[model samples]
Target: MRATVIHAPGDIRVEDAPEPKIVNPTDAIIRTVATCVCGSDLWPYRGLEPVGDPHPMGHEYVGIVEEVGSEVSNVKPGQFVVGSFATSDNTCANCRKGWQSSCLNREFMSTCQAEYVRIPNAHGTLVATDEHPSDELVPSLLAVSDVMGTGWYAALAAEVKPGSTAVVVGDGAVGLCGVIAAKELGAERIIAMSRHESRQKLALEFGATDIVSERGEDGIARIKDLTGGIGADSVLECVGTSQSMSQALHSARPGGNVGFVGVPHEVAVDGQELFFSQVGLRGGPAPVRRYLPDLIDRVLSGHINPGKVFDLTLPLEQVAEGYKAMDERRAIKTLLTP
Candidate 1:
């Protein structure tokens, strides 16, 4: 089998790798169909995270199950399934409480950007759709594995509710989807901060009511203006930078909620500021498995299409170019087919 591997910073290659097999009673082996480059993956590419020797490259996909372990009763052979980026045993205490990403007994679904992948706790981690979807539905269904779920979590964490103002800081794919989630949750006003026309358009299509082509204080001011001098009721911080986080906190009204989904790196909150502002902060690595079922159902029913995030597509062998495109900011997200 061939897999995408990052040998070092800026060095991505397609290399030969051994085929995967079911190693646990709850495991399943699946042949990869579609996968993509993720924003988080860029950390290692940019020398932020230590790029281990010849590490596998992705954590999202939709594929055909090749085999299932003896204990895997829910997923079966030949079923088309979508899985969470992080796998978990559904029976665990954390999982039962809807925190599968932090399950006490957890195993991550091996990198998906390869010809084959080993998914542990298959029965609990993978969701099988009614039928094999059309080629077009594949991309959207693929999103249920990660970004879409994370975006939904962003809105949920922010406490977005009916008739509330929801401001999203960041114009990335997850931030755009957070706009959709906020609207679906009944937010009356959805403000997306973006200057890029392409991303701004997608945000609008996803249910953004207004666009703020400002950053820093200008962006926060726009949000405040939209909210009639008061800050928004809910703010979703989708970028994992201190600038974005501060903007998120300032964009929300006092006593409002701030949900951050970006992978924080050396970020800290000022105790006095938070105390004086009276805004609530909540967020962490998204427990995507918790929303996998409902999200998959919505995609299967054609109610939402999150695949719009992937603006470019490439073959598995050309994955090196995919990473370059994303790292260079030339693509919003790149979808790769194996």
Candidate 2:
């Protein structure tokens, strides 16, 4: 087996690795069929995040279960599954409250960028549907593993409602999914703030009612114009930057809510500014596992294809090329196959 390893900044390689084996009663092992490079992965690659030691690099995947432990019941050895970025024991207090990311005994999720991975707490962390689609739907299924989940979280946190005007910040995969999420929640007007033509097209396809091509005050002006001088009813922040965060804040009307799901690189908010506004702020590391079941059903039923965000594909050995394309802003997202 081979896994993607990041030895240092601007460095990535495929190294021979041993096949993962189930070591606990609740554990399961899966062979990776499809995986993807996320915007978060670029932080380490671009030296924006620390790289203290060589580490495995991926957190999204969809594959077939090669083996399962004795205690695993819901999922079997031969089933196809989609897993969250966090591994949790579904029986725990937090898991039952729709917050599996904070499960009492949750295990830190490892990158699934390899050919094989050992999934702990398999019964609680993995979900199996009827029939797994062929290679064509693999990318879409894998999207539910992370970005799509995070986007859905953003919509929920923002308190979106039908006939409500919504604004989305950032044009990444997660932001685009936020568009789909807002639509699913019945937002009457979806305003996608995107400068890139490519992502703007996808945003519209996902149900954005309008597109704003400006930044700073100008972007906010466009959003206000669309809403007839009032701001949006809700705003979803998908970029973890001060500028993007500020734009989201300025685009929401009084008493509106903001759902920020970006990784929060170095965000700072002005207390005085927020104090005078009626907008509410809330968001954090997404509880992706919370929505996996509903999302998987939608995918399996063909209600959505969030996986269309992947604009580039590469073989496992050429995984480095996939990273380069994304880091250089040449591709929206990259999908890798084993």
Please give the lDDT score for candidate 2: 0.89
Q: How many clashing residue pairs appear in each of the predictions shown?
A: 0, 1
Question: All models: lDDT?
Answer: 0.89, 0.89
Instruction: Compose the digit string of candidate 1's lDDT tens values, residues 192-227.
Output: 998899999999999999999989888878888899
Where does model 1 exceed 4 Å of error? none
> Pick by TM-score: which candidate is best?
1
Model 2, 148-213: lDDT tens digits are 998899998898999899999999999999999999999999999998999999999999989998
Could you list the CA RMSD of all candidates, in the order they appear? 1.1, 1.3
The alpha-carbon deviation from the true structure for residue 307 of candidate 1, after best TM-score superposition, in angstroms, is: 0.6
